[model samples]
Every structure is written in structure tokens, then in C-alpha cells.
Target: MKTAVLITIGDEILSGNTVDTNSNFIATQLKEIGIKVLSIFTIPDEESAIIATLKKAFGMADVVFTTGGLGPTKDDITKKAYADFFEDEMVFSDEVYEHLRTYLEKRNRLWILDHNRDQAMVLSKAKIFLNFYGTAPCMILEKNGVYCFSLPGVPYEVKPLVKDQIIPFLKEKLALDSIVTRIVSVVDIPESILSETIEEWELALPKHISLSYLPIGSRVKLRLTGTGKSRTILEKELDSEIQKLIPLIGENIIATHEDKIEKILGELLIGKKLTISVAESCTGGELAHLITSVAGSSAYFLGGIVTYATQKKIDILNVNPRTVEDFTVVSEQVATEMATGCQSLFKTDIAVSTTGVAGPGRGEDGKDVGTVFYTVRIEGGEVTSKLFLPHLERLDFMNFVSQKILQDIVSLLIKKNKSPQLY
Candidate 1:
């Protein structure tokens, strides 16, 4: 397989002011084209650092991709680094200059073209891929039979350049194999135990097939990847291997295809023709947000309410004020009442509720931070659970609780019927 290294160039990324989303996007695109990403490097925009990283990347992989540090203010540093590394000189490109002029003119910002004129400079020995979405163009240079592609930092520009130009170029130039993958999401089991249980099946796998255990929240996702020349053969091989894995851990598996819990729940709800609603407190509207994030979620998602305050919960979801007074708003009793009220209010087949203290400070009722009580109500039957996760921060606490709630709901739906519709 063709291997590549992704280098993210920016101080903002290193300082956590900006995330390095480009590496992940580029890596995924490369993986689809049968190129395996070997390493990812995030470094500041220094010419010495860029050149050093380029040398290391060229030594390690057949292809190298770098994103960021291509803006008008910083292009000189990156360009000089590329030229220094590739034994070339910076040369002005009339074609790139005209393209930039057109791009700015169309946007009616041609007045600043002189200030942005440096964006037209390119390595004398490099091939230029015109950037349609931005001023900075993608530069591709080759050294000792290895290829390096330097792309703009902006995600929108990076996406189109990789999709329309770079990916197609690599596909046409290389004899790439097909990579197929399948994910089995397992719940109610620890990762260590699950790994031990599937040890035999994992060991007996084919040479081209590989397995990875990815633990997300309370679920263990067994990602089985197959790589070969033929896509059809790889897919069939993956299916056959998954079928062999069913007997050992079939009962614990919530999904065999979908990766995200929200998407998995969405599929289950659509299959069962069920409508769902949520009443959230400490989790804010994250539970509702996750539900609606999936496409066509409106088919099954009725509505949601975020009753953060105790009185709001009592007023909107009709949680009994006496129950809140007795249980202090973050108890299982209040969670169950919220779920029931949400079910009645939305008139949906399923209702989910979360009442927790997600904070750096304690709740109004003095409940400790990360103390969550959630209930998943289905057709009048309900399951209430509690979790005390004092270690998690506010946002993480919300997200983790929301994920667990969705997973629990999916599990309940699956277990409620003898034969659940998973598709």
C-alpha cells in the first residue's frame, strides 16, 4: 500500500486556538484511495521546522501532505522552506497571479490584489494545482521518487483541492488497492473482556485483514479492515469474518454497520417506526442536538426541551415540584418524572431525560459536579440510571451523558423485541 505522512503547519493549531482538522480529512481521503497515513505532525510555521519535517516525511513515506501556513502573510516562510528542502528557488507564476486576480475580482476585493500578490509565488520545480475556493494554490513537489503536496490551511479550500485535484491525480498515477472496513459496536461489556473473548477469531483472520478496538464512551467498536486489489473480494472477506465473530459476542453487539451511537439509534427508531423526544437539564440540549444531527431525523425525532432550572422543569415538562423538592432535582425520581412528562407532552413512543450537575461548580441544590441521573422511557416502560463522574469537565460531562443515554435507549429498543430491526 502507498503510505503517506500528514504535517499540519500552524502555531494556532499547536496552541489549541485552532484544531488540525485538515490532517484527519486528508487522511480519510487518502485512505479511501488506498493510501495509508503513517504519521501526523503538528508544528509551528517556522521555515526550519517545515524543512526539517519535510525531510523526515520524505524519508518515511511514499507521499507527504502538509496543510496550513499558506496564507498571504505566511506563504514566504513555507515557500522558502519548500524551496530549501527541494533544492529549488521561488519563482513568480503569471498563471497563478492571473487566477488570484480573477478570484479576488469576482469577490469584488481586487483593491487588495497587490497586498495579496505574494500568493502567486511558486516553487520553480513544482506542479501547481489552482485553488478554486481561495487565493493560495496547492503546490506538489517530488524528491527522490517521493511526492509532497502542500495545501492551503483553510478547510474549504483543502477539501476541494484534495477531492477534485489531488485525490484524482494520485488515483490516476498510482496502482492503488481497495480498502473495505466494517464496525461492530458492542455494549455492556468491558474492552479487556471483549478483546479476550474475540482473541481466537482475531488470530484466525486473513493476512490482509486487520482488526482495531476503538472504545467510545460505554461501547467497544471492533473495526475490521480488509485491504486487497479487488473491492468486492475484500468486502466479502470482511462479511465472512464478521459472521464468524457473531456467536462469541452477538448478544452484546448493538450495531454491526454504523459507527456513531446517534446514527445507530436513528436507524433503530426508523426501523421500528418510533418517535422520540427528550427533556434535558444538566446535559443542556446536547441529547436533542445529537438526535437531530442525523439526516432524516425528523421522521423519528418529535421534539425536545431543555428545562435547566428546577421551576422550568416543573412548568414545561410538568415535573412535580414536590418531587424536585424531595429529590433535589438531580435524582433518579426527578429523571423518571421528566421522561414521563416529556413522553406525555410530545406523545411520542419514546422519551429520554437527563438531570445532572455538569459544572466546575456544584448544582443549585448542592449536587456534586458530574452527578447525572437519566431515564429512557419507552411506551410507558422506563429505565432510570445514575452516573457520578466527578472527573469530567462541563462539556465532556454533557457529551458523555448524552452518548450513554442514546446507547441505553438503543439497547432498550433492541432488547424489548426478540428480533430487533437493526437496519
Candidate 2:
């Protein structure tokens, strides 16, 4: 496989002022076209630092891709650094000047300063790719049979250049093949236990296929990637491996496709033609937000109630006052009542509730922080409640509980036909 290195230049990234997303975007694109990214470097915009990083990166791989510091500002010296590193000087390009002039004129940016026009300066002996999206042009330099591409750091500029220009150039230059990837998401199973259970099946996989586990919230994503001369063969091999894995871990797998928990849950509800509602306390409307985030969610998601106050839960959802007085707002009994109340309020087929104390400190009834009780109720059937104590931060705790609630809902739906109590 062809190999490449990515370098992102910005002091903001190091100081945490800005997150470096350019490297990830470039790396993923490279991988899809059969270029393996060896390493990624993040550095300041200092010319000497950029030169040093570029030299080291070019030494390690066939291609070096750098983003950032290609603007008109004083801090943008990536172009100068490239000139110095290549033992060349900057040369003004009339073609680039006209391109910049037309770009600025069309945008009604008539108050163009000299610095803005300086974007036409080019590195001598380098190939230039015009940036359709921004002022800074993409640059390509070749030395000792290695190629280095310098792209604008702005994500919008980088995306079009990579997709329209860089990808095509690299494809013809490297003669790359497509890389196919498939995802199978499993939930309610710890990674360690899942690995142990599927060790034998995993070991029997073909050499070209690789499996990676990525954990999100309470779910584990099994990413299967296969690269070969033909995309058809790679997909077939990946699908065959997935089928083999099904018998081993299919029961634990909530989604066989690459989608978030909410989308997967939404699909399940839509497939079964079931309508749902939610009653939330500590998680607020987070559960509702997740459900409604999916497109066409109105088809299955009826509505939700954020009964943050215990009195609201009692008065609005008609939870028995005695129940909260005896079991507390964060108790399983309260969660169950909330779910049942939601079913009645929305008149839906299914309902879920989240009652928790997602806090930096303890909540009422002596419940510790991150203490959450979840309930999923089938309108005419049984209710399942689970207590999850993840001890996460306030927002994280809310997000995790929302995901867990959806997970529990999917699990119950999967077993509703098998279990007499669930039906």
C-alpha cells in the first residue's frame, strides 16, 4: 500500500484553542484510496518548525500532506517555509493573481488590501492547484521522488481540494485500489467479554480482512476493513465474515449497519410500526432530543415530557404522590411510573423514562451523583428497569443514560416476541 504522513500547523491546536480535524479528514480520504497514513504531526506556524516537520515527514513516507498556515496573515508562513526547505524562492504568478482578482471581485470584496493580493505568490519549481473555495492555492512539490502537498487549513477549502483535485491526482499517480469497510454495532456487551467470546471466530478471518473495535457510549462497533484489487471481491469477503460473526455475536448485535444508537432504535421502531414517548427528569429532554435527531422521527416518536421537578412528575404524569414519598424521585418505582404515565399521556405503543441524579454532588433521597434509573414499558405488557451508575460528568451522564435507555428499549423489543412477560 502507498503510505503518507499528515502534518497540521497551528499553535491553536497545541494550546487547545482549535481542534485539528483536518488531519482526520485527510487520513480517512487517503485510506479509502489505498493510501495508509503512517503518522500525523501537529506543530506551530513557525517557519523553522514547519520546515523541520516537513523534512522529517517526507523522509518517512512517499507523500507528505500539510494543512494550515497558508493564509495572507503574518502568521501564515507555510509557503515561505516550503520555498526555504526546497532551496528555492517565492515567485509571483500572473495566473494566480488573475484568479485571486476574479475570486475577490465576484465576492464583492472590493476593499482588498495588498496582503490579500499577496495570496498569488507561489513557490518556484512547484506545481499549483487552484483552490476553488478559498484564496490560498494548494501546492505540490516533488524532491528525490517524494511528493508533498500543502493545503489551506480551513476545512471548507481542504474538502473541495482533496475531493476534486488531490484525490484524482493521487489516484492516477499511485494507481490505487478501493478500500471497503463495513460496520456491525453490538450493544450491552463489554469489549473484553465480547473479544473473549469471539476470539476463535476472529482468528479464523482471512489475512486481507482486519477487524477493529470502537466503543461508543455503551455500544461496541466492529469495523471490518478489506482492501484488494477489486471492490466487489472485498465487499463479498467482508459480508461473508460478517455472516460468520452473526452466529457468534448476532444476539448481542443491535445494529448490523454503521448508524448511531438513536438511528438504529428509530429504525427498529419504524420497522415494527410502534409509536413511542419518553418521560425524563435528570436527563431532562436529552432522550427526546436524541430520538428527534433522526429524520422522520415524527413517524414513531410521539412526544416527550421533561418532568424535572418531582411535583411535575406527580401532577403532570399522575405518578402516585405516595410512590415518590416512599421510593424517591430517582428510584426504580418512580421510573416505572413515569414510563407508564408517558404511555398514557401519548397513548403510544411503547414508552421509556429516565430518572436520575446527574450531578457534581449528591441529589435528593441521598442518591449519589450519576445514579440513574431507567425504565422501558410496553403499553399492554411488562416493564424493565435498570440502574446505571457511570459517575460521568453532568452532560456526559445525561448522554450516557439516554443512550442506555435506547439500548434497553431495543433489547426489550428484540425479546418481546420471545419472552412471555415482554409481550
Candidate 3:
């Protein structure tokens, strides 16, 4: 199959003021549809450069994608570039102008002028794509079996337009085969160990199934993509292979999709109409903040505590100072107590807590940095302390600990869901 070329138009990109994220993003999306991105080019908002690149891209690739220069700003020059290439007059469309007017009117700044009018111009024969997020209408020009697409440069605008509209159209037009993808999330485990253990299984994968690892924050995601005529056969092979490789580190699997642990917890709590609370130490209020970041959180989140200082842990969460002294600050006992205390304080069905060393340096007890501990307490589920990394700087440790805690909470929720009440 022929490949697609992604062209990013911007003076800012050449100057390095803004990264060319659209190219990478488009490449990923294209790959999902079994389309290959042959080359990516970024140029200043100059007409000659853009025209030259477009001509080359149209010849070299099956389709050409241009983003970033279709905005209302003066720096955006894609409008004239499209007008010049199509050999057509540029006229403002009432439909696009209404959209642009509404865009500025919502923000209360609708002023009809050349700049705004220019942003609304489209080729008479071009396919118009509405922008759900921005005013720059995407134009698709087709000629002699070549496709050229232009979109707003901004990530927020370009991403949705391309994802929701452009990709689907391309898929249908190309008669591309359906893509089957399998994803798995693993937490409380490093990518290195998982990779090392899964080496053999990975090698056994068929040529159609390609594996890629995307490690974001503290979690590692394994995504397997397979392109073929038989999706069922591929999915079975993928699921069986995933299961076979999983037993080596089954305890660390978070969920199959890209959802974070906190997100998984939110879904569980909301589905069951359960509520949760958190207590924190070295991880800060990040655990609570993570839970609240989701929509409809007020329905499931009772509350939480920061308790950065030991006194607050003792006074607010009722953490026994003796336990803190006996096991030191970053101990399993303290983590358990914190979880239980928050569960009681919030009076919710579930609660999670963290007490650990997130450190740029060693702790007061000379313990190595990143000595983190997590505890999860559900009404009848386990109250267990799981230790993760033992050495990382403060920021890394905080991020790692929060991820571990979230994973623990999710595991407990899953376990609780499986087991019926003994009462």
C-alpha cells in the first residue's frame, strides 16, 4: 500500500517555538488505519515553500496532510496556498462564515473583516470539514486520484477533526482493511522486566501483529496491532498470546486500555455507586487530585487529606505516632493505618492511603530515596501494603507512589467486585 505524507506549515515550527506534534499524531492515527506515513516535512508559512512541498507530497504519497497554517491569524497562509493550487476563486462560504461568526460570538468578538473572511474561504469543489473546536475549516481537494487535506495547526483543533472525520473518510475511500489492536496496561512493574520476560512470546508473534510499548508517567502500556482479513483469528491469537505472557507478571496488570489507574477506579466506583476517599503523605494530595480530575467525581469521591507533616497525619488521620516511630515514616504499618483512618473519617465504602519516601535525598532514617508504600481498604476487601521503588528522586518517587497506590485501589475494587458479601 502507498504511504501518506504529513506536512506541518508554520514559521514557529522551524524556529522551534512550537513542536510539530501534528505530524507525529497524524502518523500514529494513520498507522492505526494500516496507513504508513512515508515522510514528514515542516516549513515556514511561505507560499512557494508550501506549494513546492505540496506538489512533491502529492506525487510521492497516496495522500498529503497539511496542518497549522489554516488559522485566522496573519501568519497562517494555507488559505491562499489552497486557492493558488486549485486554480479556483476564493470566496467565503456562508456556512463556514456562520461557524466562524459563532466561534467569535461565543467569545463575544465577532468582527467581520478580511482576516476572518479569509479564514472562511474554501474551494468550490473541495470537501469541507467542520471544526468542532476551532474556526479553521478543513478543506480536502481531490484530483487525478490524489488527495490533499488542510487542517488547523493547533493540536486541540487538528486532532479531533482528523480523528473524528478525516481518518474515517480515508478508510472508506481507500477500502482499507479493518485494524485490530490489543492493549494491556501493567503497573508496579518496570518496562525492562516485562520486556525481558516477554522476549520469547514477542518473538513468536506473527508478521501481521506489530508490538509497541508506550510508557507514560509511571505505567507501561503494551499495544499490539494486527492487520489482516480475519480479525477474529487475529484477536484470538493476540488474546491467547497476551494471556500466556501475562502469568509472568499477572499481579501487575492494571487494565487493558490506556486508562490510568485513577480513571479505572472512578469507573468502578461510579458503576457501583460507591464512594472513595484518600489520605496522603509523601505522594502529597496528588492521589486525591487524580481522583477528582475525572468528571462526575463528586458522586464517588468523599474527600481526602494531604497530611504532609507527621503531626497532621496523627491529628487529622489519627495515625499512631508510635507506628510512625516504630516503622519510621515510610513504613507499611503507617500506610495501612492511614488507609483505615481515611476510610473511617470519610465514612465511605473504600479508601486508599500513601505514606512513603519521595526524595531528592535520603530520609531521616537514612533509608534510600523512593522507598514508597501504599495501602488500600475496602469495606471487606484487603488492607494490604505494597512497596514499589526504593530509590528515586522526590518528583519521580511522588509520581511512582501515586501510580502504585492507584493500581492497588483498582485491584482491590476488582477483587471486591468478584467476591460477594459474606455477611
In model 2, the Cα lDDT at residue 230 comes to 94
lDDT for residue 256 in candidate 2, whole number 0-100: 68
Over all chains combined, what TM-score does candidate 2 have? 0.87
Ranking by lDDT: 1, 2, 3
Candidate closer to the true structure by TM-score (higher is better), 2 or 3: 2
Report the lDDT tens digits of candidate 1 across residue range 1-423.
999999999888989999888988999999998999999999888999998999899889999998888888844478878888888998999999999999999999999999999899999999999999999999998888888999989998999999999999999888898888889999999999998999999999999999999988888899998999999999888888888998898889898889999999999988889999999999899999999999999999999999988889889888898998897888999999999999999999999999989989998889998899999999969899999999998899999999998999888888988976443
Candidate 2's residue-wise lDDT over 32-133, tens digit each? 898889999999989989999988987899899999998888999998899889998898988888888888888988578365877988988889999878
Number of clashing residue pairs, candidate 1: 0
Better of 1 and 3 by TM-score: 1
The parts of candidate 1 lying over 4 Å away from their true place are 74-76, 421-423
Instruction: Write the candidate numbers in order of decreasing TM-score.
Output: 1, 2, 3
Give the lDDT of residue 129 in candidate 1: 99
Q: Report model 3's TM-score to 2 decimal places.
A: 0.74
Best candidate according to lDDT: 1
Quote each prediction's TM-score: 0.97, 0.87, 0.74
Q: lDDT tens digits, residues 1-423, model 3?
A: 547999888888999889888888998898778777889998889999988898888889888999888766777788788778777777769898888878878887765544577777788888899887887888998967988898888899988998999988998889565467767877667789889988888898889888998886567878888877666787787777777866766666757654566677777777778988888888888888878888889999989988888788899888898998898877888888888889889999888888766767676766667666777777856466655566566766677667666766676666555542211
